[model samples]
Target: MRKTVIVQDSPPSVRLVQVGTEQAGQRIDNFLLRLCKGVPKSHIYKAIRSGEVRVNKGRTSADYRVEEGDTVRIPPIRLPRADEPRPVPPASFPVIYEDDAMLVINKPAGVAVHGGSGVSFGVIEQLRAARPQAPFLELAHRLDRETSGLLIIAKKRKALVALHDMMREGGGRKHYQALVVGDWVNDRQHIRLPLLKWLTAAGERRVRVDAQGKAAHTIITMQKRYGRYSLVGAELRTGRTHQIRVHLASSGHPIVGDDKYGSDEVRAHFARLGLERMFLHAGRLELPHPLSGEPLRLEAPLPPACLKILDYLEQHS
Candidate 1:
């Protein structure tokens, strides 16, 4: 008796997903991008434009904010199976603190906070891949790829919203340690400069001091001196893109190993001394608990390499 094989070809089908609280406030286009991995962005937008994507039985624009309990209709999309992108590898970092509502980790320098602008994957993606059972995980805030320290990841949507509100209302205190090239004269000083963001001819993002820009305030305190070099503590009063680096550079004391704003000669000199990355660290953060409103203070010590650089400066001086 010969067994007969059964095969049936079926076309791709539409999918309806209900938005959860954790995914609220995200634009529809971004939501689809993450949901339909490996699909072209142009196709996503085209579907939205052609009224193929719908929310609550009504067509919505790509920029429409998704809310909890909203049903989203996703049209079937074909992805390139022959040249699919590699999967994000599971990764983890040093945990500074962890609770029900949040997870704080010591993010290392050179790893992006999230994948974008040519980066295929970053800390968030890796963490999500590592903890596949996690229901909700989102970044409370972002740190530049070159800066390393206590980075917060919210475990709940309510916690994330509270953290964003706290940041916007200046309810937290953030401090950074930067090793600069020149001897800083001020024992303590407040640098209040407005910063304007612009794109260079190559489309690279850059921030500069301009009157028509957003106000940025940084409180600087000289921590130590090593001949021509000085270690300074920067307290961010108003957080802006590249605020501390731009402020220090504008004051003629660019940070050591800062390629974007520091002197070429200074960076080369520090490179010889074993400082390859930017000498900036987010050392401390003081704020009230996002969910409980209890005051909390978190700190991450400087990396071993940064400490070694300081030791070298001390011995040479």
Candidate 2:
């Protein structure tokens, strides 16, 4: 059963018998934990810590004093797991931006950009399946499986060829936002590192900065600071495989939650801080329209999970 109460100086009335509790003196968190046994403890603690649970229509700490006959307002509980499956479209992507030659989408993380070895379903394939009448869509760029952001797709072969030419000629720009370890001493710095592409022990493609590698450069500026970590804005001068991650790692500050270049100790530290994935995102992109030659800019906001972690750090630290 659910209960609601209005905020007033007088304590609201709660019928303890309704919730199978006639006892008092239990802490609010403890009582709620008992009342909602199926919910994750972490989530309950989070809500309590965030002041979402209140006692007597007033904000109370998790350890607040509880008396008999006191009223409590329990916010609607959010289930840990999804309750319904995502709606899958019969045809192509939900286009966020479109013009005569190019299309953009809020590409979800965990979906590959193109088909590879054993994978048959990728963004391209799904688009084709949904829009059989349109010719095959071409990728203007690629994003890793764990990254989410605006993605550009070319509708015509000529458009793809032209975009590729522009990128090769250093006519395109890309910017990323990353939560990295360590407090940057300088407000802005440039990383000029060469990257060599190689396969990992598990046969996954990876890149590292080496003397003999292809040239890569990125400019980084500090956006915000949270104790040992800082949110940074990265502008790419040249596109290379894992360029931002490699350059930042080489500079002695790997991105937080980065499993590839960061050590296990660093990963564990971030985990303890409640980060579940690599603290990196493709924040924005800028380029000329493939056919019209007009400039276009696209931006994506940080995901809620990422922001939640940041908020925790800020409040606790």
Candidate 3:
């Protein structure tokens, strides 16, 4: 059974009557070890050190003094579990454009942009697995896992270098489609926000708009609208982590299925409409060819799942 106890005073008191008898003057971490059997000592120490396990309803140092009736709130442990079996590589990921120097793919939603952490395989890995003899294919940029659409991969080192340089020179055009929570009256608007990195309790990276952070800019155009939601097109002038999602959310028009930034009402409404993933897609990309020097433009059609949601909205609206 689980139980909760409130800390009402300093040197927070804890009553672990069922687990073990309290020992006076013991370090908080040591006391927790006796109370929580089979749990790693390091884990307990980390919890105390990180301030997750609090004393007296306040953050405390690991060396915090403890008394007979002090209350301690020991948060449950959360550790990364062992790796699971790898997912099977897709038989074929649709190719939107291909040439000697570079290739563009219409990446499906639920597929990672690149491999990291315990993810042994991602779109880039699968692509290399499919073409073992290809020199090397490097991702020019990245899209979120739940986002689908045009992604460019360079087939050679030279191509990768050229494409990276082109991106830096502002020579590429990227367009995205997103379903936002509210009707936007303005046909076109520019969002200039700065983004800063934050690390969560679980050590996951997140981005937020702060004046002290890196500059980001995006241009939004109203593509169409339903009763309450609007399908908008976004063009990024400066690429930043979750730039569009953060900007639109800050404007009080969060993207559908974006639980991190979207409102609960919007999330529930989209869920009722069968939207399971973020309703965003990288629809179009235009850049100069690495080898041919010709302008290369590619379009990735909306995935079937995205279309289904749009179709439902059309019918209901």
lDDT of each residue in 174-196, candidate 1, tens digit only: 99999997789989999999999
Model 3 residue 80 lDDT score: 28
Which structure among the candidates has the greatest lDDT? 1
Residue 13: error of model 2 in Å?
79
The list of candidate 3 runs beyond 4 A from truth reads 1-91
Task: Give the 10-residue window scoring lowest on summed lDDT in candidate 3.
Answer: 1-10
TM-score of each: 0.90, 0.67, 0.70
Go through the candidates in order and give each one's C-alpha lDDT.
Answer: 0.87, 0.72, 0.76
CA lDDT for candidate 3? 0.76
Give the clashing residue pairs of candidate 1, or none.
Answer: none
Model 3 — TM-score against the truth? 0.70
How many steric overlaps are in each model, in order? 0, 2, 7
Residue-wise C-alpha lDDT for candidate 2, range 158-213, written one tens digit per residue: 68778888888888788888888888777999899889999978888889888999
Query: Residue 132's C-alpha lDDT in candidate 3?
Result: 52
> Who is ahead in lDDT, 2 or 3?
3
